[model samples]
Structure formats: C-alpha cells, structure tokens
Target: MAEHGWLFWALTSAVFAALTAIFAKVGLQGIDSDFATFIRTLVIVAALALFLSYSGKWQNPATLSVKNWGFLVLSGLATGASWLAYFKALQLGDASKVAPVDKFSLVLVALMAVIFLKERPSAQEWLGIVFVASGVLLLALRR
Candidate 1:
C-alpha cells in the first residue's frame, strides 16, 4: 500500500488466480501433472527473460545479492513443491475445497508482512480479506 503501484499487481494476481484454476482444470484432463508443471516453468522462465529484455533490466545485477539468489532458488523449489501437491490435491478432493485451503496462504502472507516488514493492512484491505475469505468458504460449503 505504501507503493500504490502494487495495486496493479494485486489486481493482476486476482485474475491470475481465477485463470489458473480454470486452466489447471483443463490441463489436468489429459496432461501428466508433473510434466505440465515442468513445461509451465519453461514458459515462466521464457516470459521472465522476455520481460527483462523488454524492460532493459537484464544488464543490472548490482541490485541482487547472494541472499536474493538464495531466496529466488528457495522460491522456485517452493513453487515446484506446491504445484505437485496442488495438482495431486485437486485429483483427490474437490477443487473448491482445495482452492480455499490454498487461499489461506493469503492470510499467512498478511501475517508474515506484519511480522517481518511491520506492514499493516488498512481498513480496505481487511474488508477485501473478509470478502475473499467469505467467498472461499462459500465455495467450500457442500450443498
């Protein structure tokens, strides 16, 4: 919130989440889940490379430190692990149930930001969280 530019990222992320659910459903229809994830990584790496090139930010390495590299590697590992677990979860459980459980990461992140960055959600953010949580829960509810 300090940087209003993050608003765009937040909006984009919401779209990405919905798209991910729909596309993952279609992807699971025929593709091997692990193979699908591996292929997606290539797409992501290519997209990132393209973004860096287009932004003309590829030349700059000074801003990144060893810790940044460590974090990036860790993040990639986490992503791969989560993808496997998620796809398997979807195969076993209802997507609506699995999705809301997954969305708890949002709450975890908010708490982590408060602890690590001393950042607090504003009133609007809390309201957004309420709506997000409610939607997820409603989705999870059995008819």
Candidate 2:
C-alpha cells in the first residue's frame, strides 16, 4: 500500500489542479494576472507553513545542502513562472481551453525526463505520452 501511495497522491493532485484552474479563472476577473499569482503564492506559502508546523515536518533550511537549495530555488522559479503564465492565459482565454493546453506540460515533462534524467519510459508509457501530445496539438491548433 505504501508503494502505491504515489498513485493516490497523484490523483488527489489532479483533482486540486482542476479546481485551481476553475477557481483562478473566476478570481482573475478585473485583476492583473501577476497580482493574482502573487496572492495565490502567498496563500500557498501560508497554508504550507501552517501544515508543516502542525505536522511537525518543518526542517531547518540551513541543514539542506547547496545542491538541494539550488535545485529547489530553480524549481520554485519555474513554478512561479508557470503559474504566472497559466493565470494570464486563464484571464485571456476560456478556462476549458486554457487548462487543457497547459497540460501540454505533461508531454514536455516526459520528453525532458527521457533526455535529461535518462529515464527510459516503457513503450506503453511512450504511447500514452504520444497520445497526450496529439491531444494537446488538437487543443492548441486553431480550428
């Protein structure tokens, strides 16, 4: 059960992601997307801080190695950029369209994992990635 824990968490993340798009779209009305993203980031930070404290999971930042800090900072920057772009898209486009197009990251991640991480996905996984890429193309191309 513990080995399959990731599957449960991944599904939960998907549900939250779907809700995030819907809620962000509605909240973005009459607001600057960058400002909205900042507000969202603040809420996330506060929530995580509280959760970490309550769960006794808070760790001393100074204990982390340089490599851990560097990669985490890079990941944070990437996440911030992604959220800003996603919020801007949601503000300008239909949520239904913007969300699916944003999910194109799935295909990009798989390809990047193969190239950079040297992780070879099984053929079945590659097939799914190809289908996801095709679907993203279908969503992105002008009809």
Best by TM-score: 2
Could you list the CA RMSD of all candidates, in the order they appear? 3.1, 1.0
Give me the displacement of residue 106 in model 2, in angstroms. Answer: 0.8
Question: What would you estimate as the lDDT of candidate 1?
Answer: 0.80
* Model 1 regions more than 4 Å off: 1-3, 60-63, 122-135, 141-143
* Per-residue alpha-carbon lDDT of candidate 2 for residues 1-143, written as tens digits (9 for 90 to 100): 99999999999999999999999999999999999999999999999999998999989899999999999999999999999999999999988889889999998999899999999999999999999988888887756
lDDT of 1 by residue, 1-143 (tens): 57899999989997898777667767777767777777777898999999998998786667789999899899989888998887766666767687787887787788789898999899999888778777777877757
Tell me the deviation in Å of residue 8 in model 1.
2.1
Prediction-by-prediction clash tally? 0, 0
The lDDT per prediction is 0.80, 0.94
lDDT (C-alpha) at residue 25 in model 1? 65
True-structure lDDT of candidate 2: 0.94
How big is the positional error of residue 47 in model 2, measured in Å on the Cα after superposition? 0.3
**Which regions of candidate 2 deviate over 4 angstroms?**
none
